[model samples]
Target: MLTVYNLKMPHAVYGGENAMDNITAILKNHQAKRVALFTDGGILASGLFTLPEAAVKAAEAEYYVLSDIPPEPSYTAVQQIVDQFKENGADMIIAVGGGSVLDAAKLASVLVTDEYGVKELLDTPGRAKKCVPTILIPTTAGTGAEVTPNAIVAVPEKELKIGIVNENMIADYVILDARMVKNLPRPIAAATGVDALAHAIECYTSKKANPFSDTFALEALDLILNHILPACDDPEAMEAKNRMQIAAFYAGIAITASGTTAVHALSYPLGGKYHIAHGVSNAILLAPVMRFNAPVCEDRLAKAYDRCCHEAENRCQSDSEKAEWVIGKIEEIVRHLNIPTSLKEFGVPKEDLDGLVEAGMLVQRLLVNNMREVTPEDARNLYLEIL
Candidate 1:
């Protein structure tokens, strides 16, 4: 039996031109005197800080900025951010970059008002009593961390990338200004865009998928498949980039309701052990896992293709064929974007394949969402095929 679904997202969403102007209003509304800003070094160097910094200054709010966020943030790193947020006596937070920074901010905000450690809170979902109000501004168009209740954090000691899912992690406000995504490089654009697409695809095929998740996922898939290439070709094209950003945000909402499946579950170890960027890892595994799941999900994939494919690709004869066509298109996109298609590119020694499989097996929470159950042997073969 299917359970009724509840969608999760930020309280208010601001986008397009003049979105940054609302920051000052939120600060005042909350009577927030001091604000914490979190971002990655790449965004800090991109000169996108001017607007938000000015907004905070104009509101007469003291701002504390932390821009040293790493590619995939770790549990210890977020704990440090939590300490700093509390130490500065920040009453609110402004997360001002991509997924990593937003996730760091999400974890930090929840930890600031509670005594729970990162592991405890993530491991036990509803323990946090409260969290500081937060406003998220996406400098990059992927990860959809702006409105998600889940945050991905790396645990280096265990060589695993884990999700911290909690309702309190949701941001109070989300800003999606295209100006911030203008300088994204071609590779990052391609990888992150595919990452967003994977979120929609995986959720659409997840066991927990319902009418609401399918609606959001299909819409997100449409937006992403149509505009991803245009956005990559011209980062300065605000229209294309805006569409991709919206696609990512929609996919975020979809996954929050239905959750992601084997693709995300299998990719975590690649991220944690090899330090392959999370998006790239997802890209590598997406096609293979989709192909694996196709036998059981052909009708669903056919429906996805029918809704998302262009006129040129819509003439496929059968559902099985259409499913293969969808898989092929993803491969073509990855090739066009110059993403590495194999684990060997990351130089994983063949002998260590077992370790990767072991790590992937541990992500049963996500694996259970797969339309077809993922067995240990199936996991091994999937990695071997990719290798």
Candidate 2:
């Protein structure tokens, strides 16, 4: 834990039932006249945009929809969306989708200037600042893009995803309405739920973990581990879905205060190269990376087990036993979710192992946060386990 640490969050957050209705008041408060709505085709097609659209109309705001953003978008792709936002001349942005859409909108809010854009920020993130305020409405419970200062984009040249970190990019407002995620397809719900699971555990065990992060990270673990299965498996389980939404946001807060470790670092290559969903890639690597770090992080993992596992029959007395149980529980969750546990499902050949190792190693910003230092050999072996 660091002697000095700080926590950052959105200016305001509204959640629970009818949270989407807050959008109208938020628009009025921002005095946003011309609004730019950012999302992808799938969200628009799913009619998930209806609530926010109605809210925007109720505010009597003139809104233009920018729904061309792709999944796991490249920086150039984000630049294109920024250019479209610039051309439309919207004074505010409302992002309504998963991580990719939210991330693209965050980039657009800051990339309005000719001086610097998403590509420039990739190399010098501090060069950009927020020009337009944003309201982020997440359709998935994972990614925590709504509350984080980081925007992840793929760098196609390197075939790896990189995070653009700037405090200015945090959402000005966040609305977490379970209605937005109520009907989410099972596969998406499963992948994203596990992604939040990875975030909570990884942040708790991070070398940078401190009092501020542990507070949220532990609670997030409890909520996610207990609620994720029902949330994903049953369509009518609104209570579980709502808790998962809050858990994802709390996990996102954990990321902002502390950080993610090797799980995220190694998973980036899979998303960047294979065009795999970010949540899916993270789900694939979550257990393996946690197991590898268990030797050094067992004490923290034991604490997590104590917090998250409340079932009387499953209690373990020793730290090692608790750690093993925690890891095993993670594996069980992944298994039950049916998220691919092996890279072979993605057709990631063994021949690509060397390249995967090289790319995963480049993400030192996150790798350094691991309590157990990850070397080139360590990364190679971790990737091989999945491959």
| C-alpha local distance difference test of each model | 0.87, 0.92
Best by lDDT: 2
Off by over 4 Å in 2: none
The sequence of per-residue lDDT tens digits that candidate 2 reaches over residues 1-387 is: 877999988989998789999999988988889999999999988988999999999999999999999888999999999998999888889999999999999999988889888888989999888899999999998888899999999998999999999999999999999999999999999998898888999999999899999999999999998999999999999999999999999999999999999999999999899988888899889888988999999999989988888888956999999999988898899899988888887888899999999999999999999999999999999998888
Q: How accurate is candidate 2 locally (lDDT)?
A: 0.92
RMSD of each: 1.4, 0.8
lDDT of 1 by residue, 1-387 (tens): 038878877889998787898999889998989888888788878889988898889889988898878889888887887777777768888999889999988888877655577878757867764468889998777988888888888989879999988878888899888777887888888889999999999999999899888988999988887888889997468899988988898898888789899999999999998899988999999999999999999998999989988877349989998899889988988888889899877888889889988999999989999998898899999999888
**TM-score against truth, every candidate:** 0.97, 0.99
